[model samples]
Target: MGAWGISTFDNDDAADWLADLSDHQSLALVRETIAAALDADDYLEAPEASTALAACELIAAAIGRPSAAARKQETLTRWIAHRKPSPDTALIADALRAIDRVLGPESELRELWEETEDYAAWQADVVQLRSRLSH
Candidate 1:
């Protein structure tokens, strides 16, 4: 069993698989984990929350390298632009707030204001980046 009882792989296999991922896959998985954390709810257990943060941080660490892939770059770009819904889901809201706190109020936070009209184009660019990386 895994966090939130969402087991998909044996711990050993999962660890090996995670270790073996390409830079792009690793980065994508990290972003995805952060997204998952944002989606968790009030009844979340400490273990569940810890797992999400752990996974999220792992991914974030991978992308810390200058050579991290374009897909990872683009994912971070688009995810930043997406506004948290009013009555925003707690997990996502907390995750976003936490990231913003880490990265600071500028760029990730401020860019939201500058990128409004260009967000669609930016998102399209992200999809293209992902496609390129997957090839």
Candidate 2:
């Protein structure tokens, strides 16, 4: 139910734990939940960390942390594939860019940003980026 250090997988237990606590406890649980949500094994349906992040947004009551833009990008990628992004995506993207200003840019954050949703798509992009960057 929990992977205390993984941000992308098995987050329900962490979210449940986080939801029961106060702001003080929330800070710590937020870290755990985010990590769990990032773990590669978190997805059983969508392959992306977005589902687990939905849990983070609900129970953690916060979205932008660490690499906020990248996180939002991850979520948006999922939404875009579904057809269209809601207005909320823009809100989250704005918040994430603000966080990025404080955190500096997290280049190569893709290492932690890939989703499990579709390996072919991800792999192609990775290859493209790698080719471009390596040149």
- lDDT agreement with native, every candidate: 0.35, 0.33
How far off is residue 133 in model 1, in Å?
Answer: 25
Give the distance in Å from residue 123's predicted Cα in candidate 2 to where it truly belongs: 24
lDDT of 2 by residue, 1-135 (tens): 333223322345423443343333223433443344344342322322333343333321232222232244343333333433222443344323322221222222233234344435543533332232222
Cα RMSDs, all models: 16.0, 13.2
Give Cα distance to truth, residue 130, candidate 2, Å: 26
On lDDT, the leading prediction is 1
Cα TM-score per model: 0.29, 0.24
Q: lDDT value for candidate 1?
A: 0.35
Runs in model 1 deviating more than 4 A are 1-26, 63-135
Per-model tally of clashing residue pairs: 2, 15
